[model samples]
Target: MCFEKCARCIGIALIPLAVLSVVADILLYFPNGETKYAEKDQLTTLVWFFEGIVGAGILMILPIVVFIGLKDNDCCGCCGNQDCGKSCAMLASVLVALIGMAGAGYCFIVSALGLSQGPYCLTELGWQYPFNSTNGRYLTNYTSWSECTEPKHVVTWNTTLFSILLVVSGVEIILCFVQLISGLVGGIVESCCHCQEIVRCNDIEVNVYEVQE
Candidate 1:
């Protein structure tokens, strides 16, 4: 009963996948910031590049997953202990919470990182550099829509979006964790109380029998 109530069957496969999805989503939230620094440091750029790529992946698939989850769940999602629990609701809750956390955590990290460097200055990446700088400052005016519109992260945009997403995601994650833990604890407490009551009843029966004898 505990196992059934605690975890869902449908989610066994989706949880880890959702984690990857979220990681990707957060990475892409600010692509401009990522590419700007890639020009200076290969290693940092690599990390940033991966982050952006992952974020993009999440953006692509998250909506589909959410739609499916919504259709399967009740309003409270995985909050249901019995009827709803067996449904898609509980699984959805867990997924949503985890995804939300991933986005939120990234936002928090980016905002904190911003203190060290000002908003990602595309100029620093030499895109804004002088004379015939085709990639940065001039690329927008020159390149085709593909090059011009493709993900070019802006630090300012990344910072702002990340910060907001983080706070919101962070809060939701906390609530989800709290709700989950509390439910478990409540079950434990109820079980213990039942056991104690059974022991008390047994003791009383023994005492009465001994007195009669």
Candidate 2:
């Protein structure tokens, strides 16, 4: 009973984590044009975009797996000594969770590395500059910048967006680990509970026959 409750709680927790990740992934597409950054970063922006798509897809599916695991647990009682369904569900959920965790971890790594290199990229792309003589002691208009309409603004937005993605990925990785452990441990405990239930039912049936005799 406790295990089931815990599984449900874990499932509920994964919902928001997954949603936040997907939303952030979608938002990552904007803030900086894909084509523009794809050129300089050796397609790092494209990589990030694809990673977002994959992360969002995995996260979206994660909730469904959790729900299925919960459903399997609820159905355990009805299945009555037959742990096939529940076992299969647990295994499937665990597999999905592992895959999701891997994806989330990859995203976290990429986003974090991007954060480290993003400032340099901004400078290289003319989004920002040093305190050099040309840029300093003199005011410059937006027209002076190339590659982006408003280079400074775009870079700021990009930096903020990447930071958000990094945080979201980190949280998701942690959540996925939690869910993974819950599913594995819960599956084992649930199996033990089902075995006890089966034995108890058999004993009750034997007692009933003796009473009838």
Candidate 3:
């Protein structure tokens, strides 16, 4: 438990994460539809690859965990069980922070490194693709977005709120991670050294064990 008796602090730490998500939600105003494509360069592949990994790690994984925290762990003081409540509260807080940070990091990576793509172009199906480089050479050959001017999958934001959210979420997550490092590491080491100790773990207790008669 990184924070004892302060689930609120953990929750507060996620404020930046939530703020970034909210900011991303409102990022359609300015429009980043560049008409031109970027020129093919050494950095393009690396940028796109990093962007993909970051995207999956953040967007796909974070929201699900955070939602769990928001919905499940309300910190019921009425339980009157100190140990149970404390563990539950800490778990919820850590889950939320981890998920939020992952999401925020994805957004940041997308913003900074960006993804591989070209300008929009009409296809045989008649539906236009947002990033079709072969048709118009948007990203791999153009210098300015204007050369490939077209709507894209992700929106752009003028305000720096997203960056701010990323920073805030990163800090909170780092703190929470630090808190977990010692305890979780100790548990893992002990369990690895002696499997019987693992049997007692609340998180990994065997629901069913079979032995030949």
Best by lDDT: 2
* Candidate 1 residue 120 C-alpha distance from true site, Å: 3.9
Q: What is the TM-score of candidate 3? A: 0.37
lDDT of 3 by residue, 1-213 (tens): 323323334444444555454444333222353323223221223233332234323443443343335333436732764444434544454555455456545655554333233223323443343443344343344344433223332212222333443454455446446434432443344334445444466334443332322
Mind giving the per-residue lDDT tens digits that candidate 1 earns over 1-213?
342233333233334444543554455333644543344542222235333224323432442354334333445533543443333343444455455446434544543343223223334333331222323233233332222222343433443444443444344345435434433554455446556777999999999999999
Model 1 has an lDDT value of: 0.41
What is the TM-score (0 to 1) of candidate 1?
Answer: 0.38
Inter-residue clash pairs, candidate 2: none
lDDT of 2 by residue, 1-213 (tens): 454455566667666666776666665554455545444553224345555556644654665466436654544544554465565555456776677777777777766655444423334445443322242221233342333343335545544655666676676667667667776876787677778888999999999999999
lDDT of each: 0.41, 0.57, 0.39
Off by over 4 Å in 1: 1-107, 114-121, 124-153, 180-188, 207-212
Where is model 2 poorest over a 10-residue stretch in terms of lDDT?
A: 130-139
Total clashes, candidate 1?
Answer: 15
Error of 2 at 177 (Å): 1.7
